[model samples]
Structures are given as C-alpha cells and as structure tokens.
Target: MLPRRSRLTGASSSDRGLPNATVARLPLYLRALTQLRSQGSQTCSSDQLAESTGVSSANVRKDLSHLGSHGTRGVGYDVDHLRAEIAQAIGQTQDWNVVLVGAGNLGTALAAYPGFTSRGSRIVAVVDADPARVGEQVGDLSIESIDQLETIITERSVSIAIVATPGQAAQDVADQLVGAGVTSILNLAPVALRVPEGVDVRQVDVAAELQILAYHEQRKGHPREEAEVSR
Candidate 1:
C-alpha cells in the first residue's frame, strides 16, 4: 500500500496547475505503461513509449516531467518505478469505492469493465429498480435492488456514483445518489443533473461525439467557396 501522505501529495492544489488536457492524458500514459509492464519490459525509452501510446516522444517527456524527473539521461525511464509514480500521482494507489445505478446494457458494460479494477476504483454495488434484473450477475458481483442503495453506500463509503439509466431517470437517480452521500458523479444519461454545492457531476453523452463528427463531415463536403469576383 502507498503511504497516505504520498497519495495526498500528488493531488495538491499546486500540482493541479497542470493543464486539464495533460491531466486527461495521464490515464493513456498509465495504460501504456501497464501494457509494457505486463509484457516484461523493465525499461523503456520515450520513443518506444510514444510508439505504443501514440503520444509524441516530446509530449511524453514533458508530461512525465510534471510529476518530477524520473527518467535517466542515457537509459530512459525505469518501467516499474515510473508506473508506481504515475499510479500514485493519479490517486490509483488508494482504493475508491463507486456505485453504479441503473443496470441496463451500458450499465452492465460499465459494471464489467476491467479498467476500473486495475485502477484503484472499484464498483462495490450495482443498483437497479427492475425486480427481474435485481439478482442478475454482472461480472463478479450480483446486481442489487435500488432500495438498498443507502445501506450499501454507507457500508462501502461510496464517494462516486455512475448514472447509466435512461435520460428520464438520470436526474432522479442522481438525486438519490446525492441524497445517499455521493460527492462525485459520472452521468452517462443525456440529461443534465443539478447537484448541491461542492458536489461534482460529469456527463458522458455517447451520441454527442457522433453529432460532432457529422457536423465536420458536412463542412468538408460543402466547403465555403472563396468569394467570387465580379466583372
């Protein structure tokens, strides 16, 4: 286990000065490092890691530098050491309890996602109102009834909740989660949720990206013609 102080150190306000974009890319770097580690690579150069993660070598070096200089001048970074440092920096070294509400298809997929387990986040409970699906198995855990949410959350101390129901139920579920003491939420439904002060809510719309892509495609095919000259 990593020391509590070390876990808190990397997330200090000073470190948050790093650009949000860079912070978002940390997971990609960490995933690449995990893959390399699993393959028995003990050491790796920035170029090698860049090839695997598709990040530029310069960018990789710059991102790693933010967490402090962990690479050697001639030999590149030590894989295990870098992995531990990155994991700790991302708060993955400590366990985080999460709850998943609305066990529909997308919810099921999230419940079975292996990425969360590898990181420190664990889905300790799955909640759904459908009685038919309540006892169903998702990955290693059994789906739980929604009525048990408060008890389960209190028992697990769930700080995060993932809302995966339809847009109509999104806000209701979010309200319930907030009521049950969740401070952070990852909302998959299309609806925007209103939470109290200090609570965090992040929405992930699956079709929004498609709409952006379609908009770009239309612009490409119907390019604005240059201004014509008169005569």
Candidate 2:
C-alpha cells in the first residue's frame, strides 16, 4: 500500500462506508486513470475522467470525494496519486492470492489472462476435478486435482477463488471452496450459490447478461413498449 501521505484529505471511502454504487464505479475511474497514466498523463480533471468513462462529471467528483480527495478546483487531480488512492481503497494495494477451479476452456482463458496479476491478483493455484486434467499446465501453474483443493488453499493462504465449472458441479465446488477457507468467490457458472454469512460471492451469469441485452435490443425495435410504459 502507498504510504499514507499527510497531504491526503479525510478518511478513505472504505473507512467511511461508501455506497455500493460508488464503490462499484471506483474501478472504472481507476482503469481510466491507469490508461491515462500509460498515455503520459500527469494530471486529470474530474470532467476529463467522466468524459472518458461516460459518467457525469458530478458523479465522478462525488465518487472521488468519498475517497477523501480534494482535487485542485481548477488544476485537476494528480493522475498517479488518484490511481494509487483508488487502488488502495479497493484493496488492490496488497497482492491478493487467487485460486482457479476447473481446467476447462473458460478456466484456461482466465488463468492465461494477464489482467489479473497486472491488476494486483496472483493466480497461485489451479485445480480440476477431472483426473485426466490433473498435472496439465495452465499458464505457469500446473493443474492439481480437486482432492488437493483444501490442502493447497490452506498452504497458499488463498482468499479468493474463481469457479468456471459446469453448472452441475458449481454447487459442490463452492461447498468445497468454502470448506477450504476461501472468503470470496467469483463464480462464472450459472447457478445460485448458497454461501454462509461473512463469505462474499460474486456470480457472473453470462446467459442472464445476454438476456438483459436481448431485452434492450427488443425494446429498441419496439418503440411502442416505451410509449406504453409512459402511460
């Protein structure tokens, strides 16, 4: 984590219990700032960030305010400083050890994706239930059997897991992940997971997201639907 500088303003947003909506947008802002930094940007006004990210300038300022940032009224914010603050608030300052479950195509792609480590997560381990897949290499890590899941997780101090298993196996995999002491899960399979309190589960239902897009597309073609709703 960046050393707490005296120049920084009030308490961080995480400390102040920022709203869920604001917390979600922090990453978007961070990504935009990171891209700007890569492009040789040293300072960024909230309006510039909002414009790049498609968010309103007011919301960009409001969300950043929660993090205790006091940007110069006219000079804008220091890009690197703001990026570090956002990353720190989001716990990306510390490297999070991650474990990937399943060795299927989706899992393979995720394991190979360079973004996770670049964004502060390290894929320490990968596990699969299929014996045939055991010992197979995914990226730099060799796939281990599900039988070793608990042991590997305990030894590596893994706090987060990505589940890319088939829907039928997702629940069982989740149960094992919880039992193995994983605190957070990013489940890609389309299944409702029942996790105990204190455990965070973020589910990504690809089909459901596609369905939502389909709804929007249908409404675009059926303008009468919007007219009826206004009645």
Candidate 3:
C-alpha cells in the first residue's frame, strides 16, 4: 500500500497541480537521483544534481522547492529521502497496471523491456489483432487476442493503455480502450488521437521530435551543406 500524506497545515506539498515545465523536468531529477543511489552515494547537494542533469543549481533548487523539499544548509538533501519524495509526488508510489493494446514492433519492444515497468507501472496484459502474434511469448507474458481486450482490462482494473498500433488503427483502439474504462493512454502511433472529455492521452512522435531538433540545429549555424549529407 502507498504511504499516506497528511494534508494538514505544515504538511508536505503534493504535485497535484504543478506547472507543466516543472513537472516535465521532475523525471530528469529522478533519473539523476536514481543514478546517485546506484553509485553508493550518500547525499547530493543541488549543485551536484544540477551538474548531473545539466540544469542550473538555482533552477534545481526552485524545482525541488515546489515539492516542499528543503535541503540541509551544509549536508544537502538525502539522496534516498529525496528520491522517495519525488517518486511519491509523481504518484510512482502506487502500482499502475497497464494494458498494451498493440503487440507490433513498438509494443513488443515496450513489453520486452522490463525497465519500462521498474518504477511502478507494469504491463499486465498484451493484446494484438494478428492471430500469428497472439499467444507468442513476450518476457513472462503471452500475447492475448484483441478480442480479450475488454475482459483483461476489466479483470485487471487497468486504467492505463498503451496504443502502439498503426496510425490508422490508433483511433479505433483508443475508442476500444476508452470503452474498456481506460482513463489514460500513451499513444506511440504517429497520429493525433481524439478522446472523450476526461480521458488523458500522451502521444510520442519520433519523427516530429527529429524535425524539431533539425530546426534548432539549422538555427544554430548549421551549414546548408549538412542538409545534402542528411538527405
């Protein structure tokens, strides 16, 4: 069970409505802290963390402040305590059972990698439309038919769905997931999804990210000759 936080006066602040930018950078801090913990480090000052993550020390301090974390004057923040607080603020303290909607390449990769679920989210079921892929072994899971989507989701009480289906099939699978009571979706398909009012959807588009990086590179005096090489 997750530890309870008292919302009384002087209690620790929660991450319920953190600014978007701060919330996005929290993962970087978490990763840096995790690395420090693995290295047998005892504690980390803000400057050390800033160097590890390439963020400024002042910015790191400000971000940690949002989580109500105040490092000691000299000794700095305790690595383990800070990690646990950040994890709790991010809701990683609770177990999240996810239903993966597609068993294609992206789905298989996500399923095969246990690191994806090491924190708190676990892919409890894998679903695919292809008969050949169904019943295939992925790690400890056997790919199940798409026909079992509703049953598996409901049985596991899954609230998160990963949509890695083809671009054209994404919306249909998302509709099915919503129908199956999935409130949040991580869509890997290269398409925009339309979900109901309360359902949350996060899309990952590698091509789009590459294009954005290219734009920045061009602005930073990247020569036109580079375009020819890239082409």
Candidate 4:
C-alpha cells in the first residue's frame, strides 16, 4: 500500500496551490484521460495512464493525488470523473478569451490551431505591427493593427494573450499586453521577457526544443561510434 503522502490529498502547499512538477504533469494526465474517455473507457488504472503518458505509475498516482483524486485498489479510477476533475483543476472548465500578437507565419499558424478551442481558450483578436499584415484574414479573425491592441483587448475582455512576434519585438508586445490587462501570456518568442509581478508567462521555444532533442541524439550516437572505433 502507498503511504499517506502517496495517496490522494485534499490540498497542496506549493505555489499556485500545487507543486510545479505536479502542475506540469496534470496536462499529461488530462490528455490521457481524454483519450480514454473518447475510447469509451469508464475506468483506468494508474499503470494504464502511465503507459499512455510515458510517466512512472507512481508519479502518475502522486500527481493525481495532489488534485484530490484516488483510485480504488482493484477497479482503478472512473475515467469521466477523473477527466472532469483534471480539467477543472487546470482551469479548462470555462472558456478564456485570448488575443494574439504578431501575425507572422508562426503566429498565423497558432491562430489557426483548433486545439486551443478544445481547451476552452479562443483567440478573440489578432494584431500585428506591420500595416501590410493588418486587415489580413486568419481563420475567423481579421488581423488588427498593433495600435488597436489595448482597445481590442478591452472590448473583447481578454486577459490571456499569445505573443508570437519576433524575438526583438516580443518584449514590446509583452509590455503592451501587460498594460492592456493581460494577466497570462503564451510567449512563443525565443527571448526571455520581464513583466510585472502578477503576470504569468509561458514560453514555447521550438528551436530550443529541437536543439535539446539533437543533444539526446548526439549522446545516443556516441556509444555506437565508440563501439565501431574499438573494432
């Protein structure tokens, strides 16, 4: 039997009411639960979830515990109930109005992504500094001028924004977003941003992720090279 610390808990002491590691893994659990629900699964074991999400079963159980969820020893967890719990925990139970800054290739692609809508976040406005890109169409949104950023945010009641501008322009856009009442930002730019105390920024650097993967590939190939050299 797992200890009390490993079992479901009613609360956490970490910042944001949950540990950062647990918060990060919640999405993985949610995604796995969503897939199971889609496949008509009514109950799933921690092992099953771990297999789907590539995490250790013990970690999976511990993470869910932080959300106050525990499964029966033999029957596991009710899939639908767990899914709802995770969604609510991650603030996906309600829709969030989001604004997009920068309408370049990466920005446009993000604006067109349907995954955000599934998570109850919708990009309500698209803005760019370049006048030529303004008035362009991205899905159901027309690119608006950067000049209208605050106005669009206020009119749409947007508190979340996606900053996909160039690395150089990202900080300026982030500043504008923070001034426009944006409390959360998804920054796709490679550069780090400095925002006010209460603002939350999540950075997504694709190039850096690829470089990390390249590092792993380099390590994996080194052993083969060493073996060949010894022959």
Candidate 5:
C-alpha cells in the first residue's frame, strides 16, 4: 500500500516544491527546533539538528535547502526563524477546528489530549451514537449525540475529524465525516477508511504498531537463525 500523505503538511511535493521525504521530515525539524528554542538556543547547526532528530547532517542540510535555507557559513540557522518557516510550511500557522466522533474509551481519551491544540488543531466537539454517553463530559466539552454530527461540524466550521469508533463502525463514521465537509481525518479504529480523492485519512493502529515491534524483537531473539536465513 502507498504511504498516506498528511494534510497537516498543507500540500504534497507535487503541489508544493518540497520532496516527499523533506515534507515528512519537516515536522521532525520543527519539533527539534521547538525543543531548542525552549532551551534558549538562538542558532543551531545542521549537525545539531541532525543529532536532535536522529537524521544525518547531510540529509538535514538537504532538507533545509528545499526551504531555501542554507545556514550561514560560520553560524547556523536561527531557531526561531526555522520554527516559523516550518510552522508555515506545515500549515500550523492556521487554526484547524476538529470534531471527535465516538465517545468510547479511545475517543474520550483522544478528545482530552492536549497535543492537538499545540499542533494547531483543536477538537471543538465530541459526539457518539450511544445515548448514555451523550451528556457525559470528556474534558471541558459535553458529549453530543452522533445525530448532531453534521450540525456541530458545520456550526464550528470543522475541517478535520478524529474517528475513534469501533472497527465495524469506522467506515460509517468516516462516511458521515466526509459528507459533513471534513477534508482530513485521524482514524484510530482498526479498519481502513475508503474516502474520495480529495479527503485525507491518517490511521493510527497501536496494536498493529506493537505487532511490528514484536517482529523486530523476534528477529533479535533468533539472530543466528536470521543470519543463516540471510545467507
């Protein structure tokens, strides 16, 4: 399967001038820059950024070059300036209202996560199909009926949604979200969503990720067997 491109990055390489790899790494650069800024770092070299982000200095320079940033010969990139540039590149400068669908355990936790606001996307509403959950509060916002989904989205001008429904209900929730004008979705359900061309879906499957880590652990546990197989 082809890797999904994140809408948070604004545009694809085809639309913007950056390569796919550079676009993906922009977030890493921004994160490292954020940490540096917090530490009072005014300027940072390519090597410093590469070390912080676990990317090679050469790749760091190459990636920054795509943004028309070539650090000074003796100095380096200004941390504040780099952060602003990456923020603009990734559409973090703009506020993105998001709606959370499904008030189950996963959905509830997602609604309370503070990282979304820090990343420029805030969950403005939460909804679920369960009547019992409708009046419950996940954070500061009271849960609403899933029947009010479209209304909440339109009223808030929400363009992004988080789908934390069960695997069986994921597709349906995705359909509703798309129909309500959501262009981007962060899906935590196990099932993959099928949306139209313009819509973007990014799935986060914790169990699947853990299984991948288990595969690597198995390889480490049987290193001799793995080596023989390589032969």
Candidate 6:
C-alpha cells in the first residue's frame, strides 16, 4: 500500500482550509514535479518549480507553505514528497469518474483528451442526443444516448459532467445533468448556464480570452480614440 502521505494532501489536511486559487495551483506544481521526477531530480528549488509551473518563486513558496513547509532552506524540496503532498491535497490520488455529454466536435475532442486520464478524472461515459451517435465508440467508452444519463450517473456515481453541446442546447443539457445528480459541471458551450445553488459550474470560453486580448490590443494603438468613444 502507498503511504498515508500518498493518499491526497487535502484529505490529510482537511482541518486546514486551502484557498481555491491555491488549490488550482496544486496541479501546476504536481505536473512540474512529475517532469522533475522523470528526470531523476530528487529535489528542486522554489525557483525551479516556479519556472516549470509558470508561477513565481515567492508564490510557489507561499502555496507550499499552506500545506506546511516541506522545503529546506538550501536543499530545496524533495520531489517524491512534494508530489505526494500535492496529489493528496487536490484529491488526485483518488480516481474521479466523469461523464461527457454531447459527442459533437468539442465533446469528441474532450473525450479524446489525454489530460484527464493522467490526472484523476476518468471519462466513464459519453452521452449524446443524436441516435446515430448513441452506440458509437469514442476512445475506450461507447457513446450512449442522453436518455441514459440518469441511469448511468446512478450506476457509476459520477460527480462531474462536461457539457460540450451547442450554445442553444447547453442550458438544457446542464439542467438534465443536474436532474441526473451531477453536482459539478465543466461547460464548454458558448452560452452561460443557470445551475442550482449546490451545483458547481465552470465555464471554459476559448474565444472570450482572445476577445479580451483583442480589446486590449485595440486600445493600445488608439487609447484616446477608444476612451473618447466610451465616454
């Protein structure tokens, strides 16, 4: 059996609440540690970790401090220890069953995505509304009709659902996911959804990021003109 430390950092340190932002960074650290471990680097300085994770050295130290100081002043952090700590904290040590809805282009890409497999999330089911796609195979899982969502959720005890349908169908799919007992949703649709109080919804708007960048770029060349137009 793996050591208790390998179970998950957050589960072990449940008493000490971690900030959501810090929790989000744990994966970045974990990925960096994985690379370091592969390279046979047993220890790493905060600066090295920060460079790999695209975070600052101070912020890395601060984030690690939340899980208690596992680093030495001169020797840096032990790779194995840091990986276990982060795995435990983010609950990645345990497998998470996930369901993907809408086997369209985006949904198919998500179903084929390798990121979730390496992390803790496993796509146990792929759901779609089209009858023709219902029995099709995606990755290792077969595409099932959305009609089977509730049954599949109950059977697999899936807690997370990924909505990859069209913008018009996003809300409807989300509603059905909620009704089927999925508490967390990662929405790839272009539209915002209204979920219940307990349901957690995370939107991934790929175009919005580009749009924001474009808005800033437009202002950079014509700041006065843009400001006057706004005024």
Candidate 6 lDDT, tens digit per residue, 107-180?
Answer: 89889999987888999999999999878989888899999999999999899999999999999989998998
Per-candidate clash tally: 0, 0, 0, 0, 0, 5
Among residues 3 or more apart in sequence or in different chains, the pairs in candidate 2 whose N, CA or C atoms overlap within 3 Å are: none
Using TM-score as the measure, name the better of candidate 1 and candidate 5: 5
Candidate 4 yields a Cα-based lDDT of: 0.88
lDDT of 6: 0.87
Instruction: Flag clash pairs in model 1.
Output: none
lDDT of 1 at 63: 78
TM-score of each predicted structure versus truth: 0.82, 0.90, 0.86, 0.90, 0.89, 0.87
lDDT of 1 at 22: 61
State in Å the error of residue 66, model 6.
0.8
Give the better candidate number (4 or 6) by lDDT: 4
Q: What's the lDDT for all of these models?
A: 0.84, 0.88, 0.86, 0.88, 0.87, 0.87
Greater-TM-score candidate between 1 and 2 = 2
Q: Write the per-residue lDDT of candidate 4 for residues 1-231, one digit (tens) a residue.
A: 545441134445454477778878888888888889889899999999999999999999888888767888999999998888888888889889999998989999989998988877999999999999888899999999999999999999998999999999999999988988899999999999999999999999999999999998987879978688779
The candidate 3 region of ten consecutive residues with least summed lDDT is 1-10
Q: What does candidate 5's lDDT look like per residue over 150-212, in tens digits? A: 999999999999998999999998999999889999999999899999898888999999999
Residue-by-residue lDDT tens digits, candidate 1, 133-229: 9889999889999999999999988999999999998888888888889999999998889999989888899799789999888767764532222
Question: Which candidate number maximizes TM-score?
Answer: 2
Error of 4 at 194 (Å): 1.2
Worst 10 residues of 6 by lDDT: 1-10
- Colliding residue pairs in candidate 5: none
- Flag clash pairs in model 3: none
* Per-residue lDDT of model 2, residues 1-231, tens digit only: 443433234455344367778878988998899899999999999999998988899999888877777688779999998998899878898999999998899999999999988788999999999999998888999999999999989999899999999999999999999998998999999888899998889998889999999999999999988899999
TM-score of 6: 0.87
State in Å the error of residue 213, model 5.
Answer: 0.8
